[model samples]
Target: MSADLLLSKLEGVRRTGPGRWVARCSAHPDKNPSLNVREVEDGRVLVKCFAECDVESILSAVGLGWDAIMPPRAIDHHVKRERRPFNAHDVLVALETELTIASLAMLDIGKGKMPSDAERERLLLASRRIRSAIELAVDND
Candidate 1:
Protein backbone atom coordinates (compact mmCIF):
# COMPACT_ATOMS: atom_id res chain seq x y z
CA MET A 1 0.00 0.00 0.00
CA SER A 2 1.11 3.58 -0.61
CA ALA A 3 2.57 5.52 2.33
CA ASP A 4 0.08 8.37 1.99
CA LEU A 5 -2.85 5.98 2.22
CA LEU A 6 -1.32 4.22 5.23
CA LEU A 7 -0.59 7.54 6.95
CA SER A 8 -4.12 8.80 6.29
CA LYS A 9 -5.54 5.76 8.06
CA LEU A 10 -3.71 6.71 11.30
CA GLU A 11 -6.03 8.64 13.65
CA GLY A 12 -5.01 12.19 14.68
CA VAL A 13 -2.20 12.23 12.13
CA ARG A 14 -1.61 15.50 10.28
CA ARG A 15 1.21 16.84 8.14
CA THR A 16 2.75 20.00 9.54
CA GLY A 17 5.36 20.58 6.83
CA PRO A 18 7.18 18.81 4.03
CA GLY A 19 8.25 15.39 5.26
CA ARG A 20 7.34 16.35 8.85
CA TRP A 21 4.12 15.27 10.55
CA VAL A 22 2.50 14.78 13.96
CA ALA A 23 0.52 11.76 15.00
CA ARG A 24 -0.68 9.93 18.07
CA CYS A 25 1.27 6.75 18.74
CA SER A 26 -1.09 3.84 18.84
CA ALA A 27 1.21 2.01 21.29
CA HIS A 28 1.61 4.93 23.68
CA PRO A 29 -0.72 6.77 26.05
CA ASP A 30 -0.23 10.24 24.60
CA LYS A 31 -3.49 12.22 24.48
CA ASN A 32 -2.20 14.69 21.91
CA PRO A 33 -0.02 14.24 18.80
CA SER A 34 3.21 13.57 20.63
CA LEU A 35 4.72 11.31 17.98
CA ASN A 36 6.86 13.15 15.48
CA VAL A 37 6.69 11.16 12.21
CA ARG A 38 8.92 12.24 9.40
CA GLU A 39 8.64 10.52 6.06
CA VAL A 40 11.28 11.08 3.42
CA GLU A 41 10.38 11.51 -0.25
CA ASP A 42 11.42 7.91 -0.81
CA GLY A 43 8.90 6.77 1.83
CA ARG A 44 11.40 5.94 4.61
CA VAL A 45 9.80 6.86 7.92
CA LEU A 46 11.66 8.40 10.89
CA VAL A 47 9.44 8.31 13.92
CA LYS A 48 10.18 9.46 17.45
CA CYS A 49 7.61 8.70 20.10
CA PHE A 50 8.22 11.23 22.90
CA ALA A 51 6.38 8.98 25.34
CA GLU A 52 9.33 6.53 25.20
CA CYS A 53 7.71 4.13 22.79
CA ASP A 54 10.05 1.97 20.68
CA VAL A 55 9.93 2.68 16.92
CA GLU A 56 9.47 -0.99 16.02
CA SER A 57 6.64 -1.34 18.53
CA ILE A 58 5.00 1.83 17.26
CA LEU A 59 5.19 0.61 13.64
CA SER A 60 3.61 -2.66 14.67
CA ALA A 61 0.82 -0.74 16.41
CA VAL A 62 0.11 1.07 13.13
CA GLY A 63 -0.35 -2.35 11.43
CA LEU A 64 3.00 -2.38 9.70
CA GLY A 65 6.24 -4.35 10.23
CA TRP A 66 9.68 -3.53 8.87
CA ASP A 67 9.34 -5.63 5.71
CA ALA A 68 5.71 -4.67 5.19
CA ILE A 69 6.51 -0.94 5.50
CA MET A 70 9.44 -0.97 3.09
CA PRO A 71 9.00 0.84 -0.24
CA PRO A 72 8.35 -1.13 -3.43
CA ARG A 73 11.36 -2.40 -5.33
CA ALA A 74 11.67 -2.14 -9.13
CA ILE A 75 12.82 -5.74 -9.52
CA ASP A 76 11.18 -7.57 -12.43
CA HIS A 77 8.70 -10.35 -11.78
CA HIS A 78 10.31 -13.74 -11.26
CA VAL A 79 7.23 -15.73 -12.18
CA LYS A 80 7.78 -16.43 -15.83
CA ARG A 81 4.85 -16.91 -18.20
CA GLU A 82 4.54 -19.95 -20.47
CA ARG A 83 5.08 -17.88 -23.60
CA ARG A 84 7.71 -16.08 -25.66
CA PRO A 85 9.66 -12.99 -24.56
CA PHE A 86 8.54 -9.47 -25.49
CA ASN A 87 10.57 -7.41 -27.94
CA ALA A 88 10.14 -3.65 -27.82
CA HIS A 89 10.98 -3.25 -31.51
CA ASP A 90 8.50 -5.92 -32.48
CA VAL A 91 5.76 -4.28 -30.41
CA LEU A 92 6.58 -0.88 -31.83
CA VAL A 93 6.44 -2.25 -35.38
CA ALA A 94 3.10 -3.93 -34.84
CA LEU A 95 1.51 -0.90 -33.13
CA GLU A 96 2.88 1.63 -35.60
CA THR A 97 1.80 -0.43 -38.61
CA GLU A 98 -1.67 -1.04 -37.18
CA LEU A 99 -2.17 2.66 -36.42
CA THR A 100 -0.84 3.75 -39.82
CA ILE A 101 -3.15 1.41 -41.71
CA ALA A 102 -6.11 2.43 -39.62
CA SER A 103 -5.37 6.12 -40.17
CA LEU A 104 -5.12 5.58 -43.92
CA ALA A 105 -8.48 3.83 -43.97
CA MET A 106 -10.00 6.68 -41.94
CA LEU A 107 -8.61 9.22 -44.40
CA ASP A 108 -10.03 7.19 -47.28
CA ILE A 109 -13.45 7.16 -45.60
CA GLY A 110 -13.27 10.94 -45.15
CA LYS A 111 -12.41 11.38 -48.85
CA GLY A 112 -15.42 9.27 -49.96
CA LYS A 113 -12.99 6.89 -51.66
CA MET A 114 -13.18 4.19 -49.04
CA PRO A 115 -12.52 0.49 -49.68
CA SER A 116 -15.33 -1.90 -50.60
CA ASP A 117 -17.72 -2.69 -47.75
CA ALA A 118 -16.43 -6.28 -47.46
CA GLU A 119 -12.80 -5.21 -47.77
CA ARG A 120 -13.23 -2.48 -45.12
CA GLU A 121 -14.82 -4.97 -42.76
CA ARG A 122 -11.94 -7.41 -43.37
CA LEU A 123 -9.37 -4.69 -42.62
CA LEU A 124 -11.15 -3.64 -39.44
CA LEU A 125 -11.32 -7.26 -38.29
CA ALA A 126 -7.66 -7.80 -39.12
CA SER A 127 -6.71 -4.69 -37.12
CA ARG A 128 -8.64 -5.96 -34.15
CA ARG A 129 -7.05 -9.38 -34.38
CA ILE A 130 -3.57 -7.85 -34.66
CA ARG A 131 -4.23 -5.60 -31.66
CA SER A 132 -5.44 -8.52 -29.58
CA ALA A 133 -2.41 -10.57 -30.57
CA ILE A 134 -0.07 -7.72 -29.66
CA GLU A 135 -1.72 -7.30 -26.28
CA LEU A 136 -1.48 -10.99 -25.59
CA ALA A 137 2.17 -11.02 -26.56
CA VAL A 138 2.98 -8.09 -24.28
CA ASP A 139 1.14 -9.68 -21.38
CA ASN A 140 3.12 -12.88 -21.75
CA ASP A 141 6.69 -13.48 -20.57
Candidate 2:
Protein backbone atom coordinates (compact mmCIF):
# COMPACT_ATOMS: atom_id res chain seq x y z
CA MET A 1 0.00 0.00 0.00
CA SER A 2 2.92 2.34 0.81
CA ALA A 3 5.05 3.73 -2.00
CA ASP A 4 8.18 1.92 -0.85
CA LEU A 5 6.44 -1.43 -0.65
CA LEU A 6 4.88 -0.95 -4.09
CA LEU A 7 8.23 -0.03 -5.62
CA SER A 8 9.91 -3.06 -4.01
CA LYS A 9 7.53 -5.32 -5.92
CA LEU A 10 8.94 -4.06 -9.22
CA GLU A 11 12.11 -5.43 -10.86
CA GLY A 12 15.48 -3.65 -11.01
CA VAL A 13 14.50 -0.80 -8.72
CA ARG A 14 17.52 1.40 -7.95
CA ARG A 15 17.82 4.56 -5.88
CA THR A 16 18.81 7.39 -8.20
CA GLY A 17 18.78 10.12 -5.49
CA PRO A 18 16.80 11.33 -2.52
CA GLY A 19 13.13 10.47 -3.14
CA ARG A 20 13.96 9.32 -6.69
CA TRP A 21 14.16 5.79 -8.10
CA VAL A 22 14.64 4.04 -11.45
CA ALA A 23 12.82 0.78 -12.07
CA ARG A 24 12.10 -1.60 -14.90
CA CYS A 25 8.67 -1.16 -16.46
CA SER A 26 6.55 -4.28 -16.08
CA ALA A 27 4.08 -3.17 -18.78
CA HIS A 28 6.46 -4.29 -21.53
CA PRO A 29 9.61 -6.40 -21.90
CA ASP A 30 12.63 -4.38 -20.87
CA LYS A 31 16.33 -4.88 -20.27
CA ASN A 32 17.19 -1.45 -18.78
CA PRO A 33 15.20 0.38 -16.13
CA SER A 34 13.07 2.99 -17.92
CA LEU A 35 10.50 3.76 -15.25
CA ASN A 36 11.02 6.81 -13.09
CA VAL A 37 9.49 6.84 -9.59
CA ARG A 38 9.55 9.83 -7.30
CA GLU A 39 7.96 10.42 -3.94
CA VAL A 40 7.06 14.10 -3.65
CA GLU A 41 7.37 16.07 -0.37
CA ASP A 42 3.59 16.05 0.12
CA GLY A 43 3.52 12.22 0.23
CA ARG A 44 2.30 11.71 -3.35
CA VAL A 45 3.96 9.13 -5.59
CA LEU A 46 4.81 10.09 -9.19
CA VAL A 47 5.44 7.44 -11.84
CA LYS A 48 6.62 7.89 -15.40
CA CYS A 49 7.52 5.26 -17.94
CA PHE A 50 10.08 6.54 -20.43
CA ALA A 51 9.13 3.64 -22.71
CA GLU A 52 5.74 5.38 -23.22
CA CYS A 53 3.64 2.96 -21.25
CA ASP A 54 0.36 4.42 -20.02
CA VAL A 55 -0.23 4.89 -16.31
CA GLU A 56 -3.19 2.52 -16.16
CA SER A 57 -1.21 -0.27 -17.81
CA ILE A 58 1.86 0.27 -15.60
CA LEU A 59 -0.21 0.28 -12.43
CA SER A 60 -2.13 -2.79 -13.50
CA ALA A 61 1.11 -4.65 -14.11
CA VAL A 62 2.18 -3.95 -10.53
CA GLY A 63 -1.27 -4.68 -8.99
CA LEU A 64 -2.03 -1.11 -8.01
CA GLY A 65 -4.95 1.23 -8.70
CA TRP A 66 -4.80 4.95 -9.49
CA ASP A 67 -5.59 5.65 -5.84
CA ALA A 68 -2.13 4.46 -4.85
CA ILE A 69 -0.51 7.57 -6.35
CA MET A 70 -3.40 10.02 -5.91
CA PRO A 71 -3.73 12.16 -2.80
CA PRO A 72 -6.75 11.42 -0.62
CA ARG A 73 -9.55 13.97 -0.72
CA ALA A 74 -9.82 16.11 2.41
CA ILE A 75 -13.58 16.44 2.12
CA ASP A 76 -16.18 14.12 0.68
CA HIS A 77 -18.29 15.78 -2.02
CA HIS A 78 -21.35 13.92 -0.80
CA VAL A 79 -21.39 15.81 2.51
CA LYS A 80 -23.17 19.09 2.93
CA ARG A 81 -21.03 22.17 3.58
CA GLU A 82 -21.06 23.83 7.00
CA ARG A 83 -20.73 27.60 7.33
CA ARG A 84 -18.03 28.49 9.86
CA PRO A 85 -17.72 31.97 11.38
CA PHE A 86 -14.65 34.04 10.40
CA ASN A 87 -12.31 34.69 13.34
CA ALA A 88 -9.53 37.32 13.07
CA HIS A 89 -8.48 37.49 16.74
CA ASP A 90 -5.26 35.50 16.21
CA VAL A 91 -4.31 37.56 13.15
CA LEU A 92 -4.95 40.81 15.03
CA VAL A 93 -2.76 39.62 17.96
CA ALA A 94 0.08 38.75 15.58
CA LEU A 95 -0.22 42.13 13.84
CA GLU A 96 -0.10 43.91 17.21
CA THR A 97 3.09 42.10 18.22
CA GLU A 98 4.81 42.82 14.89
CA LEU A 99 3.73 46.50 15.03
CA THR A 100 5.13 46.88 18.57
CA ILE A 101 8.51 45.56 17.41
CA ALA A 102 8.53 47.90 14.42
CA SER A 103 7.60 50.92 16.56
CA LEU A 104 10.45 50.17 18.98
CA ALA A 105 12.91 49.98 16.07
CA MET A 106 11.62 53.31 14.75
CA LEU A 107 12.11 54.87 18.21
CA ASP A 108 15.73 53.63 18.26
CA ILE A 109 16.28 55.09 14.77
CA GLY A 110 14.85 58.48 15.89
CA LYS A 111 17.34 58.45 18.80
CA GLY A 112 20.24 58.08 16.27
CA LYS A 113 20.95 54.50 17.36
CA MET A 114 21.71 51.77 14.81
CA PRO A 115 19.95 48.46 15.46
CA SER A 116 22.11 45.47 16.39
CA ASP A 117 22.10 42.40 14.12
CA ALA A 118 19.36 40.70 16.21
CA GLU A 119 17.22 43.84 16.26
CA ARG A 120 17.62 44.23 12.50
CA GLU A 121 16.53 40.62 12.00
CA ARG A 122 13.48 41.26 14.23
CA LEU A 123 12.61 44.36 12.20
CA LEU A 124 12.82 42.39 8.94
CA LEU A 125 10.60 39.66 10.40
CA ALA A 126 8.06 42.24 11.57
CA SER A 127 7.97 43.80 8.10
CA ARG A 128 7.27 40.39 6.53
CA ARG A 129 4.57 39.64 9.13
CA ILE A 130 2.90 42.98 8.44
CA ARG A 131 2.84 42.27 4.71
CA SER A 132 1.37 38.80 5.32
CA ALA A 133 -1.32 40.29 7.60
CA ILE A 134 -2.29 42.75 4.88
CA GLU A 135 -2.57 39.96 2.34
CA LEU A 136 -4.70 37.85 4.70
CA ALA A 137 -7.04 40.77 5.34
CA VAL A 138 -7.46 41.39 1.62
CA ASP A 139 -8.14 37.71 0.95
CA ASN A 140 -10.85 37.61 3.64
CA ASP A 141 -12.59 40.54 1.98
Highest TM-score model number: 2
lDDT value, residue 134 of candidate 1: 66
For candidate 1, write residues 1-141 as lDDT tens digits: 234644664678888988778888778776898888776655556678888898788778877776444554412223343357677788788777777777888788899986887768867886787878767876773
- The digit string of per-residue lDDT tens for model 2 on 29-100 reads 979999998988666788899989998898899898777776564223224334334467987798789889
lDDT of 2 at 21: 93
Distance from true location, Cα of 56 in model 1, Å:
1.5
Clashes of 2: 0
Candidate 1 backbone clash number: 0
Best of the candidates, lDDT: 2
